[model samples]
Target: MHRPALRTLLGARALARNPARRAMPTASHYHRTSNEASTAMRQPSTNTPRPPSRTGIAARIAHQLLAPCVLALSLGTSMSSHGAGPAAAPERPPAGTDVDETRTVAQRTRAPADCLSVVLEGVTVLLDRSELSRQAHAKPTQWKTEAERMALIEGRRAAALLQAAAPAQGSSPACHPVTQTLDGDDQFVVLAHLERGAAAVLPAGATQPVPSVAIRYLGQRCGPLCGRGSIMVSIPGQPQPFMVTHWWAS
Candidate 1:
């Protein structure tokens, strides 16, 4: 009986020492499967962000380049509008060569009711190509001089038309004249033909002499090529004779 008891005790002790061996293998396998499934169900991780595409990069570069060009073009246009910069003025051809120029002048006086003075001035001229050529010959060293030469000629011709219609101060009973000078402050003819819109109003294909009657006036004749200048005249005992004031030329 003792031996049988001892054998039973030994068998229990062996079972207690090896719990893994005593536990149900099926239960352990199920627990392990549950843990593995939980691990597998975790959320996926993200990767780092990518850079811009080639097309996008190229577009950005193009925009950067275009912005400066647009700004430069706009700046150039604004500078041109004010006539302040060194940019060249537009060149116009001389009158009466390709196109005809004619002018007329009329005057009224407050001092005398019967005194009505009228004069007409006109000329037909070609652009002095020879003069222009002479100026052009010096263009390499004197571009500004050449430019001034041409401009002076044009301005002078326009001034002559104005002088021919100058009002008179009755210096004599004949030769009513209109005039101006190169100086801006000097008095010019009240009926000067260089005024704006006069070109359209002037008669075509005719040159008429300023009449000399019932008034004294000084007349300054312009050379065929008048330099920038004006003519001056006065209407006797009048407050103001200039009905119009401004400059125009073809």
Candidate 2:
């Protein structure tokens, strides 16, 4: 082996033995690989959730704040609708009940009327409870002078007696006529009338109070000794035709 040839052969053998050195990674390569690895680690995994953005966070907060307000508004609407329902109608009093407060004062919008335009002797006549103050004697607003009805008189004994007065209602306009009438679907039922704050009681020998009306009998011929009676206007929560219980008449 000559000197130059020997050196060349030795170099070739060294290269072949350390073949990985020829492809050995450099400092720049290591740095670049390290940077790539760090970048990949910093990136989020596909399954991982991202932090909410400003717009998303703002939207979520707004929804939370408005939820209660929307609920409250809906509740208020429901309550108001319920509250606006119709009012209940007045119930009728029992039959054969009556009161006889027969006087008056200045009327109010809902004032009790003391007059009735009724059929007496085939003529529509006006019956009224007039003011005692007309005489200007200041008779205590209303003196309690009820008709002593121990033995209830006959309401219809005289032809002039009211057909049905036990169910008379309080008069408004202070002089409205009372009549037997009920309101149902534009149809009418005849109801008797009793003034406001009127009630009835049992007769002399009777034990318990009877739901009856005290009716007055007035007429053109039946003078001095007028007629009065007790009548039933209702029964067990049901409206009844005027029933004459006891009476006295011309």
What lDDT would each prediction earn against the true structure? 0.32, 0.32
List runs of model 1 lying over 4 Å from the truth: 1-48, 79-250
Error of 1 at 162 (Å): 25
Residue-level lDDT of model 2, residues 59-138, one tens digit each, is 78766764554333222122112211121112322212233221111111222245433332222223332321121122
Tell me the RMSD of model 2 versus the true structure: 25.2
lDDT of 1 by residue, 72-119 (tens): 322212111221112222222222122222233332111122122332
| Model 1, backbone clash pairs (residues 3+ apart or across chains), number | 13
Weakest ten-residue segment in model 2 by summed lDDT: 150-159
